[model samples]
Target: MPQRLVAVSFNAPTSELAGRVTGQGATLRDIPGTLFLGGGVPVAVDGTSIAGIGVGGAPSGDLDEKYARAGLATIR
Candidate 1:
């Protein structure tokens, strides 16, 4: 499948989202982006990311990782 990150804007709290997902005990890495916007795993924080949340516009390195999980948790 294609990678995608679910983010609002370039400054979206992506690190925050990734960290959240990881907080639940999941591991995510900041890799290149598939599309020009943003993208990652099915459950990513910034889906339009051109290079994953943390890799693209993540405020902090780890913060972006945390946000992804948190965002997904809200869905469930």
Candidate 2:
């Protein structure tokens, strides 16, 4: 599911699209760590999204997002 988020995020390169893909009854709700709310960030290069990094298992969703951002920074 995370991979799917990455793929959609890479293709559309927008947070709206990512969230839309995981909307209610959108087929990704059942997967664990497949949160569409936050914690998933698209990795772009030269204005093109190439990949994504997602962080899970954090105590809070905000922490998950923060860690994901940290991970993205490491590769940037």
Candidate 3:
């Protein structure tokens, strides 16, 4: 199966954690034209990243991550 990319918005919060997440995500695949934000998380199954969830427009990156993780919980 092909991997999917979902980009809802680009207004993710700017913070130290965000920078770390972005850096880590960027190095994971080392792909060009990719975005790594604080609220974006990988959905891994059996140690493989099958999908991702991205949330934005929240007051903080932590809150955005909370919502994203909540969505992931339902599917898991």
Q: What is the C-alpha RMSD of each candidate to the true structure, in Å?
A: 11.2, 4.6, 7.5
| Candidate achieving the largest lDDT | 2
- The clash numbers for all candidates, in the given order, read 38, 0, 0
**lDDT score, candidate 3:** 0.53
How close to the true structure is residue 44 of candidate 1, measured as C-alpha lDDT?
Answer: 32
Q: Give the C-alpha miss distance for residue 42 in model 2, angstroms.
A: 0.5
lDDT of 3 by residue, 19-58 (tens): 4444434442355555444566567767666666777789
Residue 34 of model 1, lDDT score? 20
Off by over 4 Å in 3: 1-36
Query: TM-score of each candidate?
Result: 0.30, 0.59, 0.56
Put down candidate 2 lDDT per residue, 1-76, tens digits, no spaces: 6743653454432233445665466364465665455566777788777777766687865676677778878877
lDDT for model 1, on a 0 to 1 scale?
Answer: 0.38
TM-score of 1: 0.30
Instruction: Please identify model 2 stretches exceeding 4 Å from their true place.
Output: 3-34
Which prediction has more favorable TM-score, 1 or 3?
A: 3
Clashing pairs in 3: none
